[model samples]
Target: MKTPACRIFLFPAMVCFSIIFLLSCTGQKIVSLKTLLMGMTDRTGITQTPSPWYKLIQASSYDRKSDKVGGKGWFANDDYTQFSGVDSSKGRKEYILLDSDGPGAIVRWWMTFAGEGSYDGIIRVYIDNTETPVLQENALKLLSGQLLAGEPLSASVSPETDLKMRGHNLYFPIPFLKHCRVTIECDSIRITANSRKPSIYYNICYRQYEKGTKVVSFSKDELLQNAELIKSTNETLKSSGTISDNLNLYSSSEPISAKDSINVNIRSKNSAISKITLKLSAFDTEYALRSTVLKITFDGFQTVWIPVGDFFGTGYKKTTSSTWNSRVDDQLKMESYWMMPFKKSCSVWLINYGDQIVKADLNIESSKYKWRSNSMYFGASWHEYHQIMTAGAESEGGTGKHRDINFADIKGKGVYAGDAVAVFNTVEAWWGEGDEKIFVDGEPFPSSIGTGTEDYYGYAWSRPEIFSHPFIAQPSGSGNFHAGLTINMRYRSLDAIPFMSSISSNIELWHWLPAIINYSLTSYWYVIPPYEINIK
Candidate 1:
């Protein structure tokens, strides 16, 4: 029940008068990990998807196996992943749907032959500078297809048809392609329908944001009293006393809500303008967005700014804004970025919460100083539109591609020691199939539970897997990547309260599994802004 955002405006809001801007540069910290990849200072952006990714493929090439019994998360499934009877020149195993460097418009697919009987193929499309136009020129209005059986099946690019299966399963409404970058090549195959001997399922999901077209969920009387106001500044702390006092939860401060328009691009290639200490700790902590803890203190001054760090993206959904005037464009998904060593002082943590701004206002970068622009009073643009135009794609609401929420850098471990926590992963899990029971800060470390090896930074099961003559007490930062990587695996959600449950955790399988239950394990930990102790 949240949808209402479509004003368009066209383009006519550029008001800025400036008000004493000047933070050129001057302070940084957190240097290690071989001096942050040897260099730092980078910026990249790209998110293009207006139509060209329509999916619907389920095969059953005559009796092998087909079982999806029952499961619901992304809401209904008809099973996918059918490159169809393969061998069409053996091509199809490429990803990066669209990457100006990283943000949205992604593409990462693998294979999975469907079942039933008669497999086919032909779904390959790619375009970045290949001259645009990858699909939809009028292949019967581009394409529109749909099929729906019963029980536990569903597919829809929506083209409607005729068929029913009591409550067993079968639904497909596919055959409508509208956003770009497509691929589905299986032109000749037949599965006239059977029973127990056909299998087909495809799931590499993308293109979502249509729950009323996106206004950015918010309706408890529109929140805002300061929207739930939890601002707890200095409630008190004393670090060299070693520190302690009125600590309802050490130090805290809350005043975030940007509305829109925030682009912090800088990968380490040496863009100059060092000295940056930005800290935004959400107070009273319990699980303030996965576990609240962001510390990015960058002042290093060697000209090394390394953080193209995969352009930051991979599951982030908390985009909502129904009636404040209407808004939707908070697409920020990142899984890597925590290395500050120019002159030194680096910390990271933006743990899911699209359309953000929680006590920000750092903007202290300088090779000489300039950007903070918008004139100061706030507002600026010349508009030629060549490139660099982020925030878009998720379908309707924007900024939410399925990532319940997580923000950690527990370099201190457990209940947070030095206390720079912002841990808010109400729940998460990754490794599946036989023998795997993980329990960190609480006791039990059964050795990461298997499956932790994939090469190019993908599947992870790092840590956990403890046995053989003792050694216990891990968690100081799990096993340090650059000296960070807390331990988590909850799968929580007992009747709402995963922060309202965008997808708090509901996936259990002793058999059927996709990408090992969507996403089994992917770890990330970093802190530099200032977890405490003179982050200057």
Candidate 2:
């Protein structure tokens, strides 16, 4: 089926119904499964501060002993087989993965297991302190599109990766009003530190809304009620190609010499750039891809500055890949669908810093936009750490010097949309065993901590295989366990982190071998003006 002229076309009806449904109850801030589903496709919704404000948090199987910064066990690598708590009161052992109270929703869930019978467990989700579970099924089957949702909504990564090593993910939001508890019941499961037999790893990203917010708790009947909407949402997410037909097209093909630049200006008020397409050719394609930079200014604010290849998720090489927001075809035609709204005018520039003259074709599509007070400007920042050395953790029998590498530090009110990392390893050992730590609103500790780098990118076990989903993708993984380049990225919709004041994102450079590597990071976000980024 062809996609709707506009995905947000369905947003109004769903949101109106949700408001009425909430009014029928307590007339409070309404948060229901329908609203959350609608939010999944509403790209503009993320730019504004979320109404009925909430905090995005994560529940993971990280080593519990790693509690303090620069403290003992801080770099511990026993990240598997850990649980929040275990329950054995009801005749069977139920290992608790996540337990939270009050109004909230589980935006994303990711899990991967090792050893025999690890995936045979029964996963159950209890809502609102219910004695019974709203969902009870085999953990792997329920998470990997065999139950509840399908395809992009619930899937395992990299069909090329071994089935047992793939990461299983579920993006379907699960909301609760009073409480929520997720557990797995498996007789073969063991809760020992660093246990390899039937080892289980998980990361659950959820939202905790403010008090007095009304939320319709998730139930099996809710899934049945919204089956058709769910199917439509899945279809909308999987839709590819151009975004809309009503956009004004602007194109240019010019050769950019060394130290020269080309600019495309859209002199319009109340407009948004809906899509951007570009292609480059040169004798040294890889060098051109790295040295040719793309910059954009929205309403006079320079909000984007990055190498074209990394910005398009191709890294420094032309690799074929696709995601919800970006794509690179077999012919190396790169495209981005990020909505960039501007007030008066916008400027896009391609700057060539390499010695070779690069031939370029750039196309941008803009549409009429109704910019409101809450509308924001899209921004991207990029940086690279060349030949950085890693100190292998004690688990690998080396000096434990694992530390956080800042991806982006923004001082402003905005939402963190997503990020991508490209790495060049110099050894044949695993290089991404580290986890992600995200701090928002000047929090003393990170609000969102992940299990591992690959896990944070919607995969597991550092499997060197290519995969693509609507929100996450690994275009190249040759460097995961060997000496080469690897690219991994994750985009957010409902899982987008909004910060009122500031946000800092970091990832640990915990390689298994004490070797030198090159790492580059590109971060995507949207913010109101008066913002400052530490990328330069």
Please report the candidate that would top TM-score against the real structure.
Answer: 2
Q: What overall lDDT, based on C-alpha atoms, would model 2 receive against the true structure?
A: 0.87
Q: Which candidate is the best by lDDT?
A: 2
User: Any runs in candidate 2 off by more than 4 Å, and if so which?
Assistant: 1-29, 192-197, 394-397
RMSD (Å) per prediction: 24.1, 5.5
Candidate 1 lDDT tens digits, 1-536? 22121111111112110100111121222111111111111111001011111111112111122121221222111232322233233453322222221011212111223343313333333333232223312111111111111111121111121111000111111111123344443333433443322333232212222222211111112111112121110111100011212211112234545432223434433222223323332332212222222323334321121111111111112221111101112322112112122322322323324344444323334231222211001000010111212222233333312221112112221111000111111112222211122222222221112111110011112222211100011111222122222222211000001010011111212121111121222222222222211111
Weakest lDDT window of 10 consecutive positions for candidate 2: 2-11
lDDT of each: 0.20, 0.87
| Candidate 2 backbone collisions, by pair | none
TM-score of each: 0.24, 0.94
Per-residue lDDT of 512 in model 1: 17
| Cα lDDT of model 2 by residue, 1-536, tens digit | 33122111112445545755667677565788888998888766765678888889999988877788667866677788788888888988999999999799999999999877887788888888878777877888779855778888999998887878899999999998899999988878865444545789999999999998888777655676689889998898997654564689899899999999999999988888888999999998889889999999998999999999999999998788888889999888999989899989999999999998999999999988888888899999999999998887566775778888989999999999999999999988899988898999999878888789999999989998899899999999999888999999999878899898999999989998888889999999999889889997
